[model samples]
Target: MILCSSTPHSSPETQPSGLYSWPNVFHVPKFTYEAEFELQQRNIEFETNGTYFNPGPKLKGNLLDGLAQEMMKYTNYPKDYQCEEVAAALTRAHPCLGQLGSKTGFWGWKQSLKYKMQNYRTKLRRLGHPEIRVNSLKHKREGQGKAAANIKKARKAEVNYIPLHPKGETIESLENERIALLSEVKKRDNEVLIKAKMENTFYLRRLEIVEQRPMIGEFKNRWPALFEESEVNAEFLRITTKPLQSKFMSQFDQFSDKLIHILKKKGGVKGQRIKNVLAIKDLCDDIDTRRECILKSVAIYLNEDPDSFFKEYLASATEDAERDISSTVMGIYIIRIDRNREPEDVGVVIEGLKVLKNVGSIILGFIMLFGLIYALDLSFPENFKYTFKFCQKIVMNLDGHKLNTKIQQLKIKLFA
Candidate 1:
C-alpha cells in the first residue's frame, strides 16, 4: 500500500510561487503523522519514539521508497546536499527512523535516498518519461561505454529543467510553434503572444539544447528571440526561478562592501595593487565604477588577470582592433563613446561572438551573460571559471554546498 502521498508539508503562506524560491531547507514530506501512527500500529518496540530503532528490512524499504517517490516529484537528480537535507529532515521528524552508529544518524538514510532516487529514475526511463528517458544509457553516444560523465541533468535549481511537452503537444507541434515564434518576435507589441509561445515550446527547446549541444552562434541563430533582453531575463527565470539581473546585482551589492574589506586585509604586493584599484576616484560614489573596481580587486585577489576577462576599446577603433575584441572568449567589452567620458555600453562576448550588446553596466552584463551561459549550456572561460562558479554556488546558492578549494577559500573570507 502507498502509505503516504509524496507531497511536501508546506504552509499556504510559505509555499513558493513562480520558479525562483530557494528550496526549503526543512522539507518535511506530507503525512508524517500518518506514517508515525502506522509505525505505532506495527507494534514496534523501542525505548522512546525519539530513539533510534530499526524498522526491519521490509518496513525500511517501504518507507524509503515512499520518501524517494516524494523527492522525485521535485528533481530526479538531487544534489548531494539536497539528499542530506531531506534525510536530515526525515530523521529529525522521527528520530526512531534514524540509524545508529552514524555521525548524524541519517547518513545511511541519505545514501539510501540517493540510491533509491537513481532506481526510481531507472524505472521512469524504462517507461519512456521524456525527461529521464533522454538521459538513458541507450541514448548515449557510441563509445561512451558507461561513463555517465555527459549526463544532461539540471545543474541549477531548474523546476522545468526538462519537462515533457505540454499536454496534447508533440515535437512537431512544438516545432511549428517555435517557427511561428521567430516571426512573432519581429512583430511590434507581440510580447504577450511571444511569451506564451516560448513557454509552450520550452520542452522542445531543452531537448535540442541537451541532445544537440549546439554552438552558441548556431543556438542563437535558431532561437533569435531568446537573446532579447526581456527574453533573456525570462529564460533565466524559467531556469532558476529568479529574476536574472536583480538576483545577481542584489547579491553582488550585499557582499561588495565586505568583499572589499576582506581584500584590503591581505598583505602583499597584490594586496597593494588591489588597494590601488579600490582607490580610484569616485569608486564609491559611482555604482558602475565601484562594481568595476570590485571585479578587478577580486581578480587580483584570486591571482587572475582582470584584462583577460575585461577589455576596453574606443568606439571608433580600427577594424583589426575590433576584430581582436570579437575573438575574446567569455569577454566583457567596454565601448568608450569618447575618451573623456564614461563608456557608452558594455558588450558580452562569448566564444568570439558578441552575444549581448548595449548592456548598461558591467555587472549587469556579467549576470546577463551568465544567464546566457546557463541557457546555452556553454562552458565558462578557463581563466575565470572559478569566478563564475563562485557566483553560481555562493551568490546564487544553487548547489551552494559543493564548492572547489578556490571558491571555498574565497567564500570563507567573504563571509568571515
Candidate 2:
C-alpha cells in the first residue's frame, strides 16, 4: 500500500499485524532487511527535500550530510539536531551561523550522480517530454525495455503471480528487445539536449537591458531600419549580443516564449530574481522500485555469507566488469537456485537443465564468454583497492561496537 500525502492523510504503508504492541518489531526476519533498505530510499528522498530549505554555502560537507540523514531518521525533526554543546561550539566557531551564499555547485561525483540524473529528468520535463524517460544515450533501448519487462515480471512473481511467456518464445529475447528500445530513446534524447544547451547559452543574453543596450543601441544607430523591422530572429540577435547575461538554462520555457513576444513587439522586460528551485527527484523514483530486490539480495547474503566457486562476488569490481559479472551472476545464480524445485526432489533441477540445455553449457563457459575479471588482481585501480580496504575496516569496526565511541569522538572533533 502506498501512503500518499494528497488525500485526507493516509497512514503509513505497513498496516501492523497488531498482534503485539511493538510497532518496531519485524514480523518476518526478511522485513528487518527491508528496514535497512529503507535507509537508502529515505536518503534519496531527504536529499531531494533538502534542496527545498536553502542552497547555502558555509555548511560543512559533513554537516550537510548529517542534516540529510537526520531529516530521514525522524519523520519529525528538532531544530538543533546536534547536541547543545556541539551546537554552541559550531555557532561560536562560525559566528554567522545561518548565513549562506549561492548554491555550491554540486559536488563529489558520488553525490553528483543523484542530482545530475535529477537535473537530466528536470530538463526533459521542461522540454515538455514529461511523458517519457531515459537515463542517457550511452545504453541500448530495446535491451533496457526487455529488462524492465522482465524485472516487472519477476516482481509480480514475488507476489505469488506467474507470467506465461508468449507461445514458443522465451523471456530472454523479450528482455533484450526491451533493453534495446530504452537505449535508443536515451541516445536520441541526449542528441537533442546538446543542441538545447547551446541555444540556451545564446538565449540568456537577452536578460540584461543595460548589457543589451550597447548592441541594440549600435543597431539602432547603424541600421535603424533593420532594428525597427518585424523580423523577430534579426531583432533577437541584437538583444542577445549583450556580454553580461547569465545562462540559466533551466527556465528555458519562460525565457524563450517571452523573448519571442518581446522581439515581435520591440519591447523588453527585466529578469526576475529567483527565490527557489524545487528539488527534482526522478532518478530516485526509478530506483525506488528496485529497493525490494536489493533488500532481498542483502538479506540473503547478510546471514548466509553465500558460497560459490568463482571468487569475484563483490570486491569493488570495475563498472564495465561489474556489468559482465552481474549478467553472469544473474544467469548462473538463477540456474543454481532452481526455485520451482521442491526440497528433496531433483525433478525440477532436471527440468530446468533440460530447458537451459542450448544455453551456455556450464557456469565456467558463461563466465568465459562474459570475460570475467579477477577483482583482486593487480590490474584493479588504486581507488578500488582502497575501497575494498575501507569495506574491510568497516566490517572490522562492526565486529566491535566500542569502535563507535571512537567514531563519535572523531565526528565531534571534525565538526568542531
Candidate 3:
C-alpha cells in the first residue's frame, strides 16, 4: 500500500462550549439489521431511546470485522479522526463497548477499527479493486520513499465523497454515461433520467474532481447538469445526506430575529451603521429584504463592507459588466434586468465565474451558492470569509466545534 504519513493528521479542535455546544444535524450511523441481529443472538441486551442505542459490553472479532466491512462501503480510506468518530459513536450507542479506563472510552476500539480498515483495504487491493488498487506501492513515485504526499480524503462530513461505482459498471462505462448526461440535461421533462445518470456516474465525477482538480468554469462545462439548481441540491444531499436549502433557511430564520436584536443594540460606529442599514424603509416588510438586511448586519458586525460582498450592476451597462463582476472570488451580482424597476434577477459568481444566474432572491442565492461551495470543495472567499464561516460553523453546525476568537466573542454575545 502507498503509505501516506505515519503521523496522525491533525484536525480542528472540537470546541467545548458556546454555539459549538449546539446539536448537529448529522445523526450517528446505526448498525445494520444483520449486525444488530447477530448482536441479539449473542445475547447482547441494549436499550433504544430515540436514535440512540445502548448494547452489551463485549464485542468479538467477527463483529468488528463486520462493522469495518460496512464502513468500507462508504469509504475505503477512513482517516484516523473519522475512525475515532466512529468509535466514539459506537461507544455512545453501546456504552458497554467502551474500553475500561480509557480517556475517551473508545480508544481501543478506534485503534482496532483503524487496523481493521487497513487490513480490509489490503484484501481489496489484492483483489484489484480500482479504488484500493490505485493506492498500491507500484503507483507510488520513485523518490517519495515511504511517505506519500497529497493524501486525498473527505475533509468534512462527506459520507459519499469517493464512492464505488454501481455493480457491473467500469470507469469507462461510467464516463460514457456522464457524456450522455451532458445532452440529456438540455432536454425538458428529463429530470428522472438525468438524475439517474448523475447518480450512476458519481464515482467517475468524483474521480475526475479529486484527480484533475478542474477549475470551476471547466468543471461546469464538462458537467453542466451538475450546476443546475436541482442537481446542485441533489449533489449536496448525496455528499452530506442533508437537504441543503431547507437546513440553511431553517437555521437562518430560527436565529435571524435574535441576531437582529443583538445587532441593533450595538453601541459604536458599527452599531450606528447597522442601525442605518436596518432603518431602510419597510426593510422588515418583505422576507427577502429582511434577510438581505441580516446579511449586511452580519458583515458589519464582522467589520466587513457588505457592498464589497454584494455588487450591483445594470444589465444594459457596457459588456465589461460581467468582466468586472468576475474579479471577486464569490459574490452576489445584482443585475438590473429592467431599468424601469427594481432588479429582479441576481447572479451568483464564484471563482471569477457566474455559476448560477437569474436567482430569485438574495437569501436563496446565498444559500444555493454556499451549497455549491461545499459540494464543489471550493474555498470561501477571503472578503466574506468570516461571514461564510459563521454560517458554516453556527447555522449549519457542520464544524462548529472550533471557533476563532472573533466569532467566539460574537457567539458569546448572541447567546448571552
**Against the true structure, whose TM-score is highest?**
1
Residues 118-232, model 3: lDDT tens digits: 8887887798765565566775557644424555555555656655556799878988998899899889999999999998887788777765678989999989998778888
Error of 2 at 343 (Å): 56
Candidate 1 vs candidate 3: the lDDT winner is 1
Q: Compute each candidate's TM-score over C-alphas.
A: 0.88, 0.14, 0.73
TM-score of 2: 0.14
Q: Give the CA lDDT, 0 to 100, for residue 208 in model 3.
A: 77
Clashes of each: 2, 20, 1
Candidate 2 off by > 4 Å: 1-177, 182-406
lDDT of 1 at 384: 83
**What C-alpha root-mean-square deviation, in Å, does candidate 3 show against the real structure?**
9.3
Candidate 3 residue 280 Cα shift, in angstroms, is 3.4
Residue 358, model 3: lDDT of 79
Q: List the residue pairs that clash in candidate 1.
A: 19-241, 20-241
Q: What is the descending TM-score order?
A: 1, 3, 2
